[model samples]
Each structure stands twice: as structure tokens, then as C-alpha cells.
Target: MVSVKSLHGSAQLLLDVAGGVTRIAERTHRTIVREINPLNRLRDIAGVPSKEREGQTYRFIQSTMSSLQQGLHRSLDGFSADDEPTHSVHSEKVAAALNGVCGDHLEASNNPLAITMHFRNSQGAKLRPDSSSMGATFPNAGPRIVVLVHGLCLSHEYWKGHNEADLGIELQRAHGFTPLYLNYNTGRHISSNGRELSEQLQILVDTWPVNVEELLLIGHSMGGLVIRSACWYGSEPKLPWTQLVKKALYLGSPHHGAALAKAGHLLTFVMHKFRYASPFALAQHTSAGIKDLRYGNLLDDDWEGIDQDEFHLDIRKPVPLLAGTRHYFLAATIGDHPTDFSSTLVGDLLVRLDSAKGHHSDALKKLRIRPEDCRVFEKLNHLALLDNKVVHDQIVEWLV
Candidate 1:
């Protein structure tokens, strides 16, 4: 069943999108009007404006929407405080999907759909590191911990896999490593999420019932970027947990950059060139997190002073693999042969083969992974890296 909160949140999100479209339409109209007539440009400079103005109309619409949103919230608040909040898998999936798109906007506006970081179990119960909580939740928890971070538009539940073959469970059963799932907002900047993850890890380590001997990080897609960012932040401050990281594995991660994001940027730029299509370009103006993926940003400086609306040179500083940790990378391709042009270009459908392997023309930007440490799998897509038995076996071999 859909909760009233979910309905309200979705309604507000739709209203926000509509308002954005209106603003884009208004801007496009102004641009076209100014370009079509020299007098309109002169009037714009003279501050006289045009006869057909949308300022008043736009303001009125915004005010009305705001009032309606507030009224809905007030009405919802009138419900009995004793009513138990219910959880629905469908609602959670919808919320996660929305967060993956415009999550940064939702977070900035304090929307209810914004996700917070939490260590969750298969049942979606939050796991605290305290003795009582850990004892109850994970009675057989081991000293070595393996954290599984999901990609963009995904949840911790994804690591469970479509079949019964989950890497986390396999590691626990075969290797004595306890598995933990991290669920966070993927729409935030990698640096922002990284810093938060670093802090959270510190707390988790400090509060663990048993001494944490080894920490292994397994990240897929954007999750890999977040892990890298976290490691950078954690090391800079000399965080204690950083020392415990034994290995970090990236699965189909876009270390250099993702081609799809760059293509989206180019499309947005092209759309902006035409007045009528400018409004449609509003769809491309995604969250800060999505924009950062244009070049697998691992630090705040990678995105600092960069304009998300226009194309800019890659100003990101190099962030290498964390020291004292064995780094491994896995690249996947949809083609049957690794040498195929489609394999190199399409690369698991989202990431390219070169980017996933950290291969770059610039030596400084290139990740330092040994030839033996990286593997390329054929005929597998990005998500397949999470469930493939061969990949899981390889991970176990490395860990053991």
C-alpha cells in the first residue's frame, strides 16, 4: 500500500518539475523574442521589457503552488501521532528512483524522499554497531568486515541479487568475513557523500563490538567513486579506520570518467543552442552528483568552480589508489570478444573499457593497478558484475 507521505512527496516533486519546465519555457521565449527583433533586444537593454511578459504570471503560479504544498503538509500533520508508519517496497523503490534523478534538489528542499546513510540488513532494518544492537542483529559477526556499496539508482537490497548467489553472502560463508550493506543518497556530490561515509566508518569502527582487523570495500559503478572519495578524505585526516582497509575492489567503475555522462553534457549544450529546444534541455540539468560523473570526481576540488551548464576542461586533480590497500578493478563488456570495437566503446553499456580499467592518456590521471590486479570479463553488463559466479569466485580468491 502507498503511504500518504509517499503520495505527498511524489506530488510535490511533480510540482517542482512543472515549475522548472515553466521557468525554462519562459527563458526560451525571452531568448527567441530578443533574437527575432532588434527592438526587443534594445528594450531588454533599456529595461523596458516586452509587452507579453510572464513575470507576473510565473510569480502567481509559484505562489499558488507553494500555498497548495503547504496546505497539503498541514492536512497530513493533522493525522494522529500514534499512527504507525508503514514501509512498502514499491514506495521505497520509487523514492530511490526519484533520488537518483533529482535527489540533490530534494535534499536542498528537505524533501521527505531524500535518503540518509544507513547500514541495513536484508529485512531493511538498520544495524547499529553497539554491543546490544550488533549482538542482536549479527550474532556471528566476524572481526573482518566487507562493505558492499551499490551504484546509482540502486539500494542495498540490490546486492542480494536476483538469484541466491550474492557475493556478500558467499564471502561470509566461505571466508569468515562479515558483510555489511551501505545505503546512501546517490544524487549528492561524491565528495560530500565521501566525507560523510568517512565519518560514518570512523564511528562504526570505534563502536564495533569486536576489534576490526581487516576492512574490505567492494563498490560498483558510482559506488566505486564514493569509496575512492571516502578513502581520500579518510586518509587526509589520518582517520583510524583508513588503516584497517586491506583491499578495495572496483567493479565496472568509471575511474577516469563515464562516456554517457559526457554525451549527456554535449546534448545539453546542443539543446541550449536552439531557443525552442532550450526548454527540453531542462531535463538534462540533473543533480550535482550526476554532473560529477562526467569525470569520476573523487575530491571536492574536481568539481569546485566548475559550471554544470557549460563544457569545461578537466580540472580534476589526480587521486590515486589508497596507500597500504591492495586495489583491484574489474571491467565488463557486452561484446563476446575483448578486442571488439563495441566492447571498447559501449563497455557494459554505461562505462567504457578504458575508463573502467583506469587507462588514460595523461599519466597522472591513470590509476596504478597492476596488470595482474585487473580483469576484463566478456559478454557481461555492468550489473552482471554484482552476481556473476566467476567474479564472486575471483573476489574470494583475492581475499583468501
Candidate 2:
């Protein structure tokens, strides 16, 4: 169920996107017309009155659109209803995808479509960081806690499907560990989410129903980068949760960088080279979070005060794995063997095998994970790492 506020937000976003597209189209059309006729180009360069009139017409249209948008906004607010329905799982998935694409924009615009960070149960009910809420949420609370985090454009629902083969349930049944799922805006900067997560974990630990003797973290894809960022923040401030963390597992995570994200960056760079194609480049524009994936950035310094659209070298600040915590890497490849050319090149069709394994050609950037702690699964793709029985079994083996 989408709320009225969300509906308004969607309408507003659509209007903004339409305006942007129209402006781009107009620019492209003008460029084409000038190319077709040198006289028009000369007139445009000479500050012709016709061009000034055209500019005034465009501004008038823009002002009219702005007035209509404000009117619509005010009309929606006049309903004076607050009993909006909660989101369904399907709607949640859609919201997650939207948040992944332009969440930062949504947030800046105060759009209700932006997802807030929370610890949610299987049914998507947010859990408060208090003893009463924690006890109620986990009737069979235990000392050992494992937090499962999802990747970009995903929710906690990814870890537990409709079947009874959920890893969280299995961990509780087998090892007396309480499983917590974290849902957050994947479109925000990774370091921003990490700082927030670190603070949230502190509250969770302080208010747990039982003593948190052990803490474990499991992350898939971009979630792994968030965990890395969180760990950096925790260790820098000597957070108590950092001391409790026993192990951190990264499944199909691009520790070095994701191949697809790098390719997209390169594509955008190429698009900027052609004046006619530059307008289309707006379609390729991504959020700050996606840009961070190009080099697995884990800090704000990596991108602060820089033009995001401009081509830049990998400026990621290296963060070492948390000390006194066992860090494990689990990567999957479509190839039948880990050493195959496809595995080395394509690597689960999204991340390269070397990137997933935390390998970097530069010594300063390498994670230096022990070879014994890393595992690669052949004949499996990136998403398959979340649901495969073999993968689950291997995780269990590592946990025990």
C-alpha cells in the first residue's frame, strides 16, 4: 500500500524528470538546427532578438509548470489525512529500487519515496532499539547475534524467501544466535550509511534484552562495502560493538571494485566527449552510492569537493579489515572452475573474481585477507550466492 505522501512524491519526481528531459531535448534540437544552418549559429552567437524571445518563451513555460506543480502540492496537502497504509512487500521492493537509483535526490527534495534505515523483522515491521521491543521481536532471544544486510536495490526480504530454508532461522535453530536484518537506503553514500549503522548498532547493543556476547555480520554485494565502512567508523571511535564482532562474512562483495560499475563510469565518460551525446549522458547519471562502487570507496574523503560527472582516477581511501575480527570472503563465478578465464574476467557476471577476493594490484589498497579465510564457488552467479544450499552450508561451516 503506497501512502498519499508517496503518491505526491512520485508525481513530483515525474514532473521534474519530464522537465529535465524536455530541456535536454530542446538543447539537442537547437544544436541540430544550428548544425544544419550556419545562419542560425551566427544569429545565436550575435545575441539575436529571436534567440532572446525564445529564451523568454522557455522561461515562461518553466514558470507555468512550476506554478502548476506548487498548486498540485498544495491540493494534496489539503486532504488532511494521516491514516496512510503501510507498504506491502511488492511496494517495498519498488521503493528499494527507486531509493537505489535516485535516493539522494529524493532525500534532498524531501520526497517520501526515500527509505529510512531501520532494523526490521521478516514481516517488515520495524524494531525499536529497546529491551521491550527486542524481547517481543525475539521471543527466544540469545546472547549471540548475527546481523544480515542486503545489497543495493534490495531489502531484508532477500535473505529469507517464502520457503523454510532461511539462513536466519537455521542459525537460530542450530547455534542459538539471534538474527537481525538491517534495511537502509542503498542510494545514500556508503560512508553515510555506515556512520548511521555504527550509531544504531551501539544503541542496539546497549538496549538488547540479553547480554550480547558475540556479534557477527553477513553482507552481500554492496552491503559488504557498507559493513567495511561501518567497521572503519567503529574502530576509529573505539565503539563497543567493534569489540564484540566475532566474524564478518562478505558474499560476492566487490572489495576492490565492481566491474559493471566501472564499465558504466567509462561509458558515461565516453558519452561526455560528444556534444550531441552529452544530453543523453544525463540518463546515465547515478547516485553517489553507485559512484563509490567504482573503487569500493568507504570514506567521505573519496568524493568530497569533486565534480562527480567528471572522469577521475580511483581516489578511494584504503581501510583495513577490523582487527581481532575474523573476516571471510565468499565469491561465486559462472565458470565451472575458479581458475577459468570466464571466472577471472566476468566473475559472477558482475564482480571480478579478484575484486570479490579483496585482491588489488596496489599494495596499499589490498585487503591482505588470509587465503584460508576466502572461498570461491564455481558454477554460481552473484545473486545465487544468497540462496544456494551449498553456499549456506559453507557459511555454516565457517561460522561453526
Candidate 3:
């Protein structure tokens, strides 16, 4: 008995209802958790009755109370990690802890802040593109600039400082390349930030008054995917390589897609159902999330971030970046359990060899990608690829 227009109207109303329900549900759940957390803490302090008691009746009551307390804690805590801080410190503090950058700012910055530094300042951000005074320098006389991008849920701190020269110092010393680390929020959708990153890079190139002889790019984990996405948008045959990028190197880049991101997608499903998940819940199933794991988003515009219907990065899809740009790729991986299932619990306490490689390599092959790439090392985790002296030396030999 319903006409087409009525059906359309009904659909729209249903959509609105669903949206309202989800938003209210999430907020109410969060609030209830906030209120009950203190109660549970007090219960802990007061000493919940022990399961093992002196009398028979006392033992039954104690055991029941213990079970109740456990349930209460689970209900209140939800998916939040035990002992995790409710509030985050300032960005400066995060930066210092991650890389020792801005001490004073760390005291002022707060959580959910973009993990990455803005190469452009507040004033520059406000100015017209033509009027902005932001500086971008690519000096021919001094060292070459190498920008390092970090992976998901991580800061540049992921670049361990153990190996001689580390990745940055080694690249600088061996190739006369200066290292620049780029940090950004991993929580946002990948392409949204990637397009932003492309513009940021363009702005950077414009501000640099120096004549850049060459530009070398490096990325870790999700950072690898961002560089790829950036190149996809920015590269063109008409553009002169000399005017912009020269070479890009991906360490543990997920060229196809990542396995961990697939797990994240699954987790997002569970979290959404339970309504007690972190904002990171979206991080798991988003298109950007899938892309970071090595699944390519070739067929659709994934920025909208819809669920299973969303397109992923097609690993085997022909890359859009120009061929002559001297692009190099390296892969890293770990075990299979958390390895294939969770990016959080992968190999070497960091990345699985498979995730690192974006391909299955039993021995954790370290190889150069492009024009018949070479595998230099056989066994190293994602972090080791950056922090290990051997990897740095290998990179130097190739660049030189």
C-alpha cells in the first residue's frame, strides 16, 4: 500500500533513527562507564569477599561476591585497557616522549592531538597560499633531506635508536642526507590525511627556497601506505621529477594491503555491536585501516569509510606513481596468530614479517623493490629494518 515516495520517506526516517540510536548509545555507555569506574575502585579498596572462606555459607557468599565484582569490573571498564590514563598530556609531552622535540609545548599539549608535527605553523595555516611565508628548503650544497613517516598508532619514537646511526643518522652520514621525521594522527581515515599530506608536501616544497638535488622518502608500517597514497595523487608524467620528488623508499611498506588491518576491520565489527569500544574501533575497519594492512582500495572512494562494502587498496593494482622515480620497497613481518590477526600483537613485539613485506616471506626477506629489486637481508622485524645498522648500511650502498 506504500507508494515510492512514502517508501523513500520511510527509509530516510529509519536512517535517522539508526544514527540517533548509535550516537546516544555510545555516549550513554561512555557516561555510565565513567560513573561506575569509581565505584569499582572503591570496592577493590574495601576488599571484596574472598572465594575461599572459613564457613560453608560464608564460602558460597564470598565466591558469589567475587564473581559479581568481576562482572562489574568488566561491565564498567568495557574495552578500555586496565590502568590506561583517562586523559592525555599535551602534544609537546607526546612529542618529547616520542622524540624529545618540544619540552615546553609538551607541558601544554593534550591527548587525541595529531601525533605529527605541522611543518606549517598556525599563522602560515591561516594565510593564502601565495601570501604564506612558510619556508621549504632543498639545499644542493649541504645534505639531502630524507623524510621518515611512522606507521599506525605510533609516533616517530617507533624508530628505535639502538642501531649505529639509527635510520636517520645513518642516512645522513652515509648519503649526506638530512633526516626529517613526519608524525601525524593514525586515528583519522588514511586518504583524508593522505590528501592533506600531499598538500602539505607541496607546501613544503614551495617554501623550501633551496634547490633540491634529490628527495628521498621513507615510511614505516602505515606510514608506508601514506607515501604510496600521496604518490598516487601527486605523481604525473608531465611533472618534472627535479622540481619535486626524486626517489621514495618504503620500509615494510604494505604495497597490497595489510593483514593486521583486516583484523582491525573484524574488531570494529565486534566493538560496534557491543557499543563499548574505543574510537580506535573505527581505526580497525575503516578503508584507511584496511589499506594500512596491505589491502588496496582500487575500485571505490574509500574515504567515506562505510563498512564491508568499502573498497580497499588493491595490492596488485598497477601503481599510479611514475616508473622512473627510483621507488624502492621493503617488507617486514612476524608470526601468524596475532601476526595475521592483529597489528597490535605481531612479531618482534612490533610488526610481523608478512605485514612488513606486504607479502608472504618465510625467512623475513629484506629486499629492494623496483626494476628487479634485491632482497638484502633475510630475517629482521619492522623496527629492526630502521634501527639495525646492517639495514642502514644496505640502504647507503643502494643510494650511493
Which candidate number has the best TM-score? Answer: 1
What are the per-residue Cα lDDT tens digits for candidate 3 across 1-400? 3333223323433343344445455455544554678864465467865332134643455455456545544554343333333322243334334322221121232221224444322111222233134233222324256777776655554564454345766677677875666766654445645666677666655555455567677887667767766766666423333245677777766554555556656566666665345433544323234433435442226434444523333333344544556766664444333335443345444444444444433222222345444342444566567676666666777787
Tell me how far the alpha carbon of residue 16 in candidate 3 is from the true structure, in angstroms, after superposition: 22
Clashing pairs in 1: none
C-alpha lDDT of candidate 3 relative to the true structure? 0.50
C-alpha local distance difference test of each model: 0.84, 0.84, 0.50
The positional error of residue 269 in candidate 2, measured at the CA in angstroms, is 0.6
Ranked by TM-score from best down, the candidates are: 1, 2, 3
Tens digits of lDDT, candidate 1, 2-104: 5666666777787787778777777777778778999878877787745445577777877887887788778775655336376666666667777888889
- Tens digits of lDDT, candidate 2, 299-388: 889879977677888878888999999999999999999899998899999999999999888898998878889999999898888888
User: Of models 1 and 2, which has the larger TM-score?
Assistant: 1
Relative to the true structure, candidate 1 reaches a TM of 0.94
Give the poorly placed runs of model 3, Cα more than 4 Å off. 1-112, 115-143, 236-244, 267-300, 308-318, 333-372
RMSD of 2: 2.7
